[model samples]
Target: MARQRVPEGPPPAPAVQKVSVRYAKRGRLRFSSTRDFQRALERAVRRAGVPMAFSAGFHPHPRISYANAAPTGAASEAEYFQLQLTQQCDLDALRAALDESLPQDMAVLRVVEAAPGALADLLQASVWQLDFEGVTLETITDAVATFMDRAELLVTRMTKSGVREFDVRQAVLASDVVLVRAGDADGRDLVRWTMTIQHTTPAVRPIDVMTGLTELTGLQVPRSPLMTRLAQGILEAGGRVSDPFDA
Candidate 1:
């Protein structure tokens, strides 16, 4: 064989653009594991033909990062992730493309150019809505009073690392019980408990609130409450929450 020459190709472009996207997991998909959601999102990115960036190595992965993923089996209106792109993209068009590619319930809610600061740091707290049936406002009100009054409402949680104990009340910024409805023929009234809580070391969950209520006032929920995260962002000193994108 004779020596031959080959043409060189253009150099790969750099990943200079960064974007942040907020999405929601609702209905049956709320039960989807974090890994499951990650796979789905990866597939959606491919389907949408997004100019995503990859790591520079023998085995490269997309430069997509998730922040504060809602626990499996919980629904959320605000979930966020960051994506690195090889080329600039219109935020609105990117949002539309992702919304069209993803499942209806798991659609993207908003997309914004990545700001200067870290996205995770901006999200310091969450506002959660916990729905309960067959629970009266009187019971919840009394429990709330006791929970807020206590200096430390300690609770135990078993994590992957190990069993840890923390005070759930300290993480609770503010809480209130709202009456969703009076009652129906069955005598089950719809009620919702909403609270703004900080993201502490061992984060406090809605179930933890239920646990604290039962521990403090002996009040019980007939069934598992529907846990939904309404919003998440920087919880200000004045108790107002600002969206991460705004910052």
Candidate 2:
């Protein structure tokens, strides 16, 4: 009997270094779910030729972790994730490769070496922009004032577990109605609002804030406002959100 030849084994994975990256979800891609983005990222990694590490087991997956994913249907400019690489490489080059591999709407914004602490911990609050049509700025301003003055404003939302109630007032650190234009060129009613909310249990969403506004002043916003996450980071002493990469 002829001796059987030895089978070839898989190459060993290299030691990984953690890198934190900031990306944006603009346009229709903002509607993509976290799982959807993850799949896209995995494909981009392969196309970018990133030397990513893998787990040990029957099935190995790329060692990647995400932090503070925005809700679906919400456009965001400050989404973030941590990627593990098999070896140290030029971050700028990696970012460029990945950006080119991804779609136009889902673009990479910044890449930096991660610090010692957890990435999630760096994201303590978020700043959101809500633009409304068919609503007067005065009405929106009054509603915000009322919501801020109140000690407690409870809002209910239907979660997967069941119905839940939380204090929308406590979650909101600060809010104001901004006037992008005194009036539209068409002279239509419009209101631009910005708010900062802390991360808490049963996170308060933009819809919940709208509900609170309606409950407070009985001013019904006819249509859903365009919601966008302007930034997510640690809320500083003066209501400013500090970027995680700066830390």
Candidate 3:
């Protein structure tokens, strides 16, 4: 086959300014996958009339970079991404426009001039909160105790590459159980499991931690336990997650 001629034209304008955004995925929007958010964001960017930079190739794409997206079916307060723009704009106004353009449940929380580093490199850990209904606080506490005591807890998850196993314990830095509500009128108990986990390859998710708990102590996790990412950033010396935007 003969070599195809490359499309000829002046290259697209280089990015003039880059801004990092922090958004929230809450309520029913949490069920939407990463690709869904990407599509929605691209549309929102157009609707908001932001001057986005594009690639030089024939099929030029928006210069947006996503970092450490939260898993599907989990709500998050600290989802982050960066956008390269062809022109500089007021961060506050851009944030408001984008927030209004997005769906009701997904809201833009913060927009700041990106610092001198990759956003992904700053996100070293995540703090997650898992709320379990129909389970006693004592049961979850015991399970967490058992999970923390073990030196290693291997769990399996089915991926596109088939069954994969990894030690969830190694990624877990700290964990605790709290009683959200004690014996409500419907006789249902709500328990919250808060944990700080280090970001690692094949990232350990809240479901994996629950699976490890079940495996270690025969704890029954609720089928629809609500999982929310409270924060994601650099892991500090005292096991706290520092804001990446503040870096």
Candidate 4:
């Protein structure tokens, strides 16, 4: 077959600078998938008049890199991405504009000049909060104890590849249960399970840990527990997750 003729125009402008951004997914917007955020961000960039660098191709796309997006149906206070710009711009201004352009629930929390290292490398762990309604603190505490006592706790999740099982216990660094509210109008107490988990292959999600707890102690986790990623960054010596931007 004859090769297609090349276009006559010059290539797209190269990126002169890169900026790392931390954003939040809150409220109902937590259900938005990663692709949904990508589309929203592209529109927001254009709306904000960002000088985004584009790849040289028939179908040019903005130079944007996303890392460690929270799963669908999970809210997050610390989500991160990077943007390559055709020219330098004031980070504060860029952040304000982008935040204003995006939906109110999807707020741009922080914007920093890109450092020398990979952002992914700094994101070594995550702190998650899972809130369950109608669950007692005692019940959750017992379940957590049972979970931690085990050498390994395997759980299954259906991925694009297929249903797969992995040890959820291995990724867990620390865990605790707390009572958030004594009782609601329905006379159900609110309990929260907070955990610090190391990032691992085929990442063990909060749901997986819930499954492990359920399997071990027959603890009934709410069908749609309020799952939120409180923080994500380097795992510190004391099982703390430090800010990636600071690293």
Candidate 5:
């Protein structure tokens, strides 16, 4: 057949801009899993009448992307979600709407237009807080210091795929492990601390660190781990710290 010429078509229009909502759940709500949080938010936003942007093709769902999925039974003060909308809306409106619909434990902190290509694009580090009881602050701090000072802190993780060896010290950026008086709970002082951690493959959870600490001490760590992701730094084009949002 003779060679036939084909016409080129113009590039597709840019996708609609969206906003990333930074929220948190503490106290009882903190125990909710990431999936639960997603569902709760979808309902709340739906009731708020936020024009949800659906995905193209089959099985369309609201274009809501959570920055990092928090593990179940963990608590977070800095959970984030990106909500794509059909049209732009007021930040205050979205915030207020979510506030009214959301539970008391979960609250929206800030609503701002997401940066171009910033959705899960820039992930630097995370700040986590762990709480426990009958644990000395000095011992915990010392252990954390040891863990941070190490050149390589390796640990084993048993995933469904299989067990794997990983270095935790590499992922730790800045951590402030302290034993704070977490107020009175049944007439007993509770131990709490905040840990600034870096995220990497085979993500290291606060619970994992706590478990390691327990293993190191062999003192039977009390008060199961309650993790809260305090902040997620920005990851630039080169994985460098660009314009980071300190949450």
Candidate 6:
């Protein structure tokens, strides 16, 4: 009988498990600059005393990374952070720990097992809701009117590389006007007429939309104007929405 080698066991699985935390920063925290928010989360995890898996080196740091942070002064409902862990902790415990260290406005909604993929690799597009306070819905509605009717919403942009023409109208996946109530923020009225816009990879920024509108309306944004991400739908290679985090 030929001696059979029971395959020397499967190769050791990757030593790391990545967990993605889906959170939201609201109220005053919305105004937190991206860097500041990162500090806040890091501090919270430390205080929560959760075992943070770190990289190997003389100066090891917790393997925590923030996904594309929200632009300054913009609020967000859908934000993400990836945490590396040596041993899996109860999601409830991790959430509670994070919550305790976080400020009232910053919150941890849920911790989902991250897919065996890179966050950056999975990102395809982002959808945003922009509410213009002290402005009429018609203003945004009209912009949408112009955007929808025109063949292209052309705007010039200056990049680190050089100036380039971006056709935002072509990239827009969705646009609409909606009313927003106050309580979402500080107990203050937040009714603003605003348009929703979605852009895909190699996408157009919101500032471009503002620039195009200003050409006609001459109104400044967020003079109490608030914008937030409604959701970020990840389009997979198969032309389908993929929730890599196993929500």
Task: TM-score each candidate.
Answer: 0.92, 0.91, 0.95, 0.96, 0.80, 0.77
When 1 and 6 are scored with TM-score, the better candidate is: 1
Candidate 5 Cα errors over 4 Å, as ranges: 1-15, 177-179, 182-188, 235-247
Total clashes, candidate 2? 0
Error of 1 at 28 (Å): 1.3
- Poorly placed runs, candidate 1 (over 4 Å): 1-12
On residues 31-125, what C-alpha lDDT tens digit does candidate 2 reach at each position? 89999999999999999999998876556799899998999989999999998888998989989999999988998999999899899999999
**Candidate 3 weakest lDDT stretch, 10 residues:** 215-224
Among all candidates shown, the one with the greatest TM-score: 4
Q: Per-residue alpha-carbon lDDT of model 1 for 152-202, expressed as tens digits?
A: 888899997899998998888888888998877889888888989899888
Q: How many collisions per candidate?
A: 0, 0, 0, 0, 1, 1
TM-score: model 4 vs. ground truth = 0.96
Instruction: Write the number of the candidate with greater TM-score, choosing between 1 and 4.
Output: 4
Off by over 4 Å in 6: 1-16, 157-165, 179-203, 216-224, 236-244
Error of 2 at 212 (Å): 1.8
- C-alpha local distance difference test of each model: 0.87, 0.88, 0.93, 0.92, 0.70, 0.67
Following a full C-alpha superposition, what root-mean-square deviation does model 1 have from the true structure? 4.4
Error of 3 at 223 (Å): 2.7
**Candidate 6 clash pair list:** 222-225
For each of the candidates, the C-alpha root-mean-square deviation to the true structure, in angstroms, is 4.4, 4.2, 1.6, 1.4, 6.0, 8.3
Return the TM-score for candidate 1, rounded to 2 decimals. 0.92
Q: Output the worst ten-in-a-row residue range by lDDT, candidate 4.
A: 216-225
How do these models rank on TM-score, best leading?
Answer: 4, 3, 1, 2, 5, 6
What C-alpha lDDT does candidate 3 achieve relative to the native structure? 0.93
User: Model 1: which ten-residue window has the lowest total lDDT?
Assistant: 4-13
